[model samples]
Target: MLLSSLYIIGITAEAMTGALSAGRRKMDWFGVMLVASATAIGGGTVRDILLGHYPLGWVKHPEYLVITCIAGILTTGIAKWVIKFKGVFIRLDALGLIVFSIIGTRIALEMGLHPVICVVSALITGVFGGLLRDLMCRQTPLVLHEELYASISALSSILYLSLLNGDVTQTYATVITLTVGYLLRMAAVRFKWRLPNFHLESETSAH
Candidate 1:
């Protein structure tokens, strides 16, 4: 079930990014599909390598690629109609992040990894794919920008791991984690919330 959910979220996010980029960059259908597939699978591929999982999740399951391609094609068509609803894309992107974080953490825990590593891995698995996608398209990565972004994913992974350790049902824990992450992200977006920035002072600052 977890894997299925991850696959769905990955495909959707890839398609959405592709479609959005298509609209924004005036890319053709094939270009959009290529970008979408990369956006969807890049992080998972990295995660599998870091986790030392052979065959990789997506490689072992070719259906994920097919789904991503189909999603890209469908989203390309739908994006034209949905372009006016800008907020919808942000919400969907948040949802994808939430789902990916939960799935990544769960997989790490199942592999008997430490909580800290699991949390970090979860964040990487959730955000790096989108970061890679944005970089490839010459856009600023959202995870590095003025929003909670990766912090929310890290928080969700930590919270979910805590709940799991406390004997919570897997389903309940996942749902709660995803909800908390999504809400936190949406709130951050709506309220323009961001982490504090620090500036260093010069030794001779005061004259």
Candidate 2:
């Protein structure tokens, strides 16, 4: 599966970043592996659980899980290099987000789920891994306050679905989605594009 191959790339890249995070916190080897696994597979796991999908990807192919763990360990030795080349990880993460979204959308579509559910699935797949990583590392959830992360995932899912619905070839739809999604994310990061955040200046309730 095209998505499966991209999924492996995404997990490997995500695991490297997660391992970098662990190093920043001075975590032990076990902590690096745990964070890496969660950051790489946590979103898909959450999405599967919510959609009641069985035989999770890692469960069906445990090698992928092992890959993430190994990636984490390797990062410990390459921590300085990883941190210095953080921009590379940013690009990988952008690509990973699109890959995860497309995969999630396709999964729900395969299950005959509603379009809305498919979009939600994409969102969960793209964002939850970062969310889980942040929670574990005691850092702020960047998705909530940073660039148009979740929105990009939603847009990619919807656009991909639209192309497919319009009878476009699966190959074209995937290629176009990957290109557009990747550029949009890079632009968002460059410009610091962010969704409007809600701020409360009062303690009063609507009641």
Candidate 3:
């Protein structure tokens, strides 16, 4: 369920970007469709291999690729309108991160991974795919920026694990962890919250 939802969000983000490109790049419909598919499935492909899942998720289900292509084609016509909604991508991205993180952690735990490994897997599931998409688009990933993006995912995964260990209800634990992660991301965006950079300039004195 989590993978499916994230896949949709990834495709949507790709389609939205491709659609809004103003046709200056001369990409035809097929090119746009290919880009969308790459963006949506790139990260999950890596995760599935790490988890030892054969054939990958979207590969085993060709419908995901078809749907992503259709979405890309549709976005080409409505790209301008979609771009006008400034917060749409950011909001959806946050929600996707929350959902995917929780689901990834849960799956890891079910597979008998240690809690720390589960948290790491959750972060990978949430952010790695998007990172690959951004790199493909020749842009810096938002997660690697100063923004508290991956931090929120990491914290949420930790929270979910702690709650699970405490015997909290599975459904409630998942809901709370996702909610916390989403709200934290939203707040970070609203407040321009960021982690401090380590680089500092020092004044040099001449004798």
**Which has the greatest lDDT?**
2
What local distance difference test score does each model get?
A: 0.79, 0.93, 0.73
lDDT tens readout by residue for model 2, 5-34: 888899999898788788888999999999
- Decide which is better by TM-score, 1 or 2: 2
List clashing residue pairs in candidate 3. Answer: none
Against the true structure, candidate 3 reaches a TM-score of 0.82
For candidate 1, what is the TM-score? 0.87
lDDT, model 2, position 10: 98
Task: Select the stronger candidate by lDDT from 1 and 3.
Answer: 1
Task: Encode model 3's per-residue lDDT on 1-207: one tens digit a residue.
Answer: 554565467556754554334233456877777666665555556666788757777778888788767877887877777678868877876887777678678777878888887888788877776676566556666668747878888899999999988999888887788788889999999998999877655975677
Which should have the higher lDDT, number 1 or number 2?
2
Task: Answer with 2 or 3, whichever has the higher TM-score.
Answer: 2
lDDT of 1 by residue, 1-207 (tens): 874775587567656786577557777878777778777877777887889867887788888877877888888778766677778778888888888788778778888989888998888788888887787678888678768889988999999989988999888898788788889999999999998866577664676
Q: Which residue runs of candidate 2 sit more than 4 Å off their true CA positions?
A: 202-207
TM-score of each: 0.87, 0.95, 0.82
Candidate 3 Cα errors over 4 Å, as ranges: 1-26, 200-207
